[model samples]
Target chain A: MLRSPRAIPYLLLLPSIVVIAAVVLVPVLVSLWSSFTPYNLTRPATLFTFVGWRNYQRLFANADFWWAFGRTLVFVTVALNLELVFGLALALLVNRVTTGRKTIRTIMMFPMMFSPILVGFQFKYVFNDSVGILNNALFSLGLITRPIPWLVNGALANFSILAAEIWMSTSIFAILLLSGLLALPQDPIEAAKVDGCNPVQVFRHITLPFLMPFIYIAMTIRSLDVARAYDMVRIMTNGGPAGRTELLWTLIARVGYQNSQMGMANAMGYVSILTSIAFTFYFYRKLSLSRRYMGGAE
Target chain B: MAEVHLSKVVKRYGALEIVHGIDLDIAHNEFVVLVGPSGCGKSTTLRMIAGLEEISGGTISIGDRVVNSLPPRARNISMVFQNYALYPHMTVRENLGFGLKIARQSPAVIEQRVNEAADILGLSPLMDRLPANLSGGQRQRVAMGRAIVRNPDVFLFDEPLSNLDAKLRGQMRVEIKKLHQRVKTTVVYVTHDQVEAMTLADRIVIMRDGHIEQVGTPIDLFERPVNTFVAGFIGSPPMNQLEAMIGSRPAGPVAVLADGTELPLPPEFAGRVTADQAVIVGFRPENLYPAGHGIPAAGQTLDMDRTVSLSEPLGTETMLFLDFGGREVQAKMLNPRLVAPGERMPFKLDLGHLHVFDRASGKSLRA
Candidate 1:
């Protein structure tokens, strides 16, 4: 029996509130609490044993954790920037297509349609040192005297994973940027031309500025997506040839699930979330600045 | 300033030709307006002249140079777009200085030109504001300022005032006229509003369905339109056209209306028509008005009584709508009067200012 209008609103919202508590809120609180304790999957009673700052102190002192964190930062930064550059180029080229535009746009999205696991397996096979398609092509073209250890070399393995990530996610940036291009008004471009700007000047001054907001929006989305990259990296290198291609997510998965160190893994996960937050904050500021420059609300 | 010339200029998109081969000449420092209803090829013609659209055939020359292949920048012309396409990211000052900057002009010259344009357009205070921060009229001024900074040989305006409210449009229209007067470069403006054409044009080119209907001074077009379309298009409330047969009276030639009413045609058209030939009689609302409430006709006038079906009182004058020749026609009354519907009023038809056109070809019967 609802006694007041305020209570009625709460009663209606109670189901979603209960569901959130059972799913998101409860799990997040449990993980946060367990990070303060030496909780392991093998010992059920250790979940309640409070270990204070032990997990966090060990996490901070761990060299492997610091290495994985630094690698992840570099991975996210390099991957997002390269994706933006390539995506912008792709969007600009696709925008120039006059005929069969719809068909081309659909085809452009084909890479994004594949599941991440499928993308991982596909790139894993392509980067295989002995029988890989890439090395075979290089050999047949007389470009290489021997098969390159694509997934074996530390630098090459990281580059391979970055390539797969860029291939699967660049279309997201292109589609978003292309929508911005389509919605761009023709008058400004024409005005720029009549204002004595050449094609390059028109693009540099008018088109680029118009696309900045869209570019920032795409960067913000892709940064968060790439930060949590695990399944693809897991299948491709499984952290490494001696942990060279190890990222934060892959390392955390191995430590938490395989090594049964859930408390240390949860601490790593919490630290890794800060990277996403930092990227998000940085991109959001850039987005708002660009929007304001375009005479939009801050 | 450079005179612009078009010789058989045409525009085609694939197999569909929108602007047929049409020729026009604009003397240096002249303000020419291309005016017509929507889809009349006026805008296409203006864009061709601006070098924004490629001519499908023929040559467009600015000054002594044939600029058919020249880009808009190379042609040395500036255009103000209908939407006032000021770059949203740039300040008014930057927008004004952009062309000069792109041209590799020194900072001093760019600043001088931009400041001069800003001063001319009264945009100094708004120089730092982006287009979105400015009001409609301010943005319009900035658009003009951008054009003005270039010191172009010709200025192209594509319905620049069409975006403003009526009150602001009137103000901008006056500003544009002043801008042309001060700048004194060749100007080609396009608009469908005939009032703008009549007010601002030194010479008006009236177009219809991809063809030039007429080209003349505003008064020349108002007083002597070469065809029925020009006659009806160039005036407000348009010239009323009533279909009739050319009948001969003992006095001279007469136009016999459908309702058996006969109005005397001007003596100039006496030899231009044959008796019983199908023709259309055209006269302005001012020419057919309340007997004493209008300008006295120098020639003969036919008087009649008709019931006013509706009245549109526009301050100094009122337009009365009533049946004439079995079709509704507009007649004007000057100096002030409130005539209600169903009230019978005495009207005069001025024979001195009458127009007769061939019904088949719609060409004026004037020599």
Candidate 2:
């Protein structure tokens, strides 16, 4: 059977197919099945007991779960948008630099080089209320007599986490957008200049439209990455100080692992998957639309 | 309309100079073509006049205004680039009107100008189509329409028809000439094709090695080139040049070839040549023709019998190659008949249309 020409392609793909089935499809199916049962990790025999819609019904009624879901939505939105704006600015500025560009580009990628866990630790030390570098610097300047509680307050903690996430991920957007800027043809820009466009008008009319596809692509990748903002958030606050900064990921982790409530957590996980899908679908549609507008391959 | 004048203009990149100091004057509403081979500073000179490149030394003035400091927009000149440069994202109508929109023109004026240019370029049918959706010729028309809508002081074309196919290029050449006639603006065009220069220019400026070799009307350059370079550069198949020594014969002065073939010099250069003076004898292919199959000569002629090495029929005429003084020389036959190789035929060289150049300087020795 393997000697046939039509079977050769499937034969070559056999290893990857087997690995994907074992690692991805099997685990996903198991979790999906477990979401319908009251499967506790401590009692493995309870995995067979079915409790259809019970975990989902409780998740809908739980106000803490809704608050975490809403907070996660806000976090992903704010982080992705701010990252896009700052990244575009960085790409444009670096593109204008004619000299020592390689050195500057390498330096620009420094933030993206550090792992998210390390970034979380670094920001945690920076935002510590009593002894952080930010408050200490403010004290040395005589600007503040007392330490500001950066990571303790409700709104300030969210802002601190946002700042850390933005710092760690904005370079992703910049690098991608910079590649787009580099590939842009110089003829259109020169033509715009000769057509009586000022620099601002040139950017607004020519440069920005040409960069739309790249912006959408960056937004798509960053949105999916930001929707799963768990490691850094867990390291920084651990959903602490009366759960002011409780996001869906931390909430689900606490319920699924710490409390050994795997069924409820799997239900939450299934619902959160909707947000990632929605974001990916929306951005891909926008990417294709912008690409079509630029007369690129659809 | 504005007349463009450049006085000793120079261009330098860092410490290396590319365009040496050169002077040229283009009259108002005249079509002047700057033509040369590749890397000959023709495009660079056009860019300098368009204010796209800064001149290192000397001044460029358009209509008595020294526009050295002004940007391309303030210069009020429109240029069609070689690549068309149509905005890929914009429709044809928007691409045509973008300049006026940027200048803060109102909707009515912009629409009027855009529609007028679109009608002129036959782009009204493709107004809503993006550049990528249009064919190559249509894109080129949009580029021209974009330049025309501005109604600029002068029109600069930088090899604008180079991207088109042969048929489209020929069509665009005629269209450009018609455009100049209808618009009547000062036009400065650049191309490397001598045929384009000959057909389109009122006066053609030939450049080589960053220097202006000659500036004349097409017919003037064709009839009396200042040097061998222009003679070879401006004609189809190029003029044939032979190295010879001037010798005194009993009848008059003759150019003696290496193989001892003596051809009578033109009457105008009778007093210019001395015995044993080395010179280059030049004549166009039409002047060297088969003996009985050419235009009736009005002056002295030199006849030779040579074997035809090759013959190329060009529909209206045939180009015959034969050995003359040990080198291949091309001769034309009008109302041509097929003549095979190794056939001996009599050829005539018209001394009335002969060109003599100094061997060392390559400059025409014509009075």
Candidate 3:
């Protein structure tokens, strides 16, 4: 019996399908099933037990978990907005550099080249109160007589983490938005200038609107990056100082591995997934709206 | 009051100068076309007048004020770009009114001006549509509407119709002429197409290598071109140019052709040529035709009994190609007839309509 042409196509796809099922589908489905159980990573036999809604109930009652979730939301929102502003400014300035443009573009990507872990360690030393460079410079400049606790105080610690996060990722937005700026057609910009628009008005009406879709894309990517703010925060703060810098991932990591309450950690993880989904959906909607204005698909 | 004047305007890029110093004066309500081949700086001249390009030297004045240092908006001129340049994010109505809005006009006045322009260009229905939604021809109309809405001192067009299909270009050409008539604004149009310049311009400025070759009315350029470049560039199926030495004939002075065909020079070129002097003689295809068929073969005839190499029938007339002066010279047959390739044919070159250019400098010898 000879194999048909239809069977050959399916035969060619068999390897990819099997790999996807083993690598992606199985792990996702197993994790989803484990979220409904009171399974402990240390006690393998507990995976057989089913305790519906118990972990979720404990997570709901735990005010600390709720605070971490809310704080992460605020963190992502504030950090992303600030990144957008700085990135747009950087891109605008870089776009105007007629000479050595390629060199400037390469220089803009220098911050993005550093690992987030290294960045965290770097900022941790800079924010150290006793002998850090910042406090010493301030003391020498007569700006501050006392050594300020940059990483100890609640507001100051959060600001320090945000500053590190922004410094680490703002280049991503600048690079993406720079590509968008370069791709923008020159005709409309010239047309706007001839239409009596001053430079500010031209930017507000023509350049910014053209860059909206790109902005939303950068926002979506940065939101996801800030939401998973683990390695940097863990190295720098470890969610200490009265849980002042505690975020979803930091809290979940402690409960899952350190405290060994995997069931409750998985429950909190499921709830935190909602925030990422909301941001992605909102950015997608905004992106499509801007694209539609550009005469692409609605 | 909106006359435009350019006095010794020059353009340079670093050490390499592009446009040489040239002067021109455009009257109010006049349509002047800057016509030239590519890289001739015709577009640069238009851009300088529009204030998009800085003039390296000299001055450009629109109406009364010198607009050398003024911005494009301050110069009070509107331009239609080659690509239409309609704002993609805005509706046609918004695109048309954008200029007025930036000028800080009242809402009612902006709306009225926009509507009037839209009405003139038949763009009322497409006003709500984006430029992406409009056809090429429709987009061009909206671009025109945008220019018209401003009611500026002058209108500049940088080959606006070059992007359209040939049929659409012909249609839009008439529309633009009618638009100028209705609006009565000074228009400085630039095009590489001589036909467009001939049909639409009150005066045509021929440019070459950034220098103004000649400036004249359409008929003036057609009838009295200053050089071989203009004679060849200004006409379709361009004038045939042949290098020849002036050979003396007892009857009169004759031009010894490249293929050794001796033809008497036109009477108008008597003093301009002497025996053994090298000159380039040109005659349009329309002036050469099958003998005894076109314009009665007046003055003198240089007869050629040659084989028809190819014939292109253009419905009303036929163009016959024959070997002359070691190259193919075209002759127009006004009355169309069936003539096959390799068929023997006799044609006559019309001496009365000859153009004689000096060989070394390509300048016309006709006074």
For each candidate, the DockQ is 0.56, 0.51, 0.47
Model 1, span B1-367: residue lDDT tens: 5999999988999999998899999999999999999999999988988888888999999999999999998989999999898898888899899989999999999999999998998998988988879888999999999998988999999999998999999999999999888888999999999999999999999999999999999999999999999999989999999999999999999999999999888889989999999999999999988878999889899999999999999999999999999799999899968888999988898989999999999999998
- The lDDT for every candidate, in the order shown, is 0.92, 0.91, 0.89
- lDDT by residue for model 3 over B333-352, one digit each (tens)? 88778889998888888888
Expressed as tens digits, the lDDT of each residue in A183-287 for candidate 3 is 888778878878887789989989999999999999988898899899999988988779999999999999989987777788888888887998899999999
Please rank every candidate by lDDT, starting with the best.
Answer: 1, 2, 3
- RMSD, candidate 3, Å: 2.3
Maximum-TM-score candidate:
1
- Stretches of candidate 3 off by over 4 Å are A1-15, A295-298, B248-252
The C-alpha TM-scores of every prediction are 0.97, 0.95, 0.96
lDDT of 2 by residue, B173-206 (tens): 9999999999899999999999999999999999
Model 1 clash pairs are none
Candidate 1 chain B worst ten-residue window by lDDT: B331-340
Q: Candidate 1 — which residues are off by over 4 angstroms? A: A1-6, A293-298
Which model scores highest in DockQ? 1
Chain A TM-score values, per prediction: 0.95, 0.93, 0.94
Clashes of 2: 0
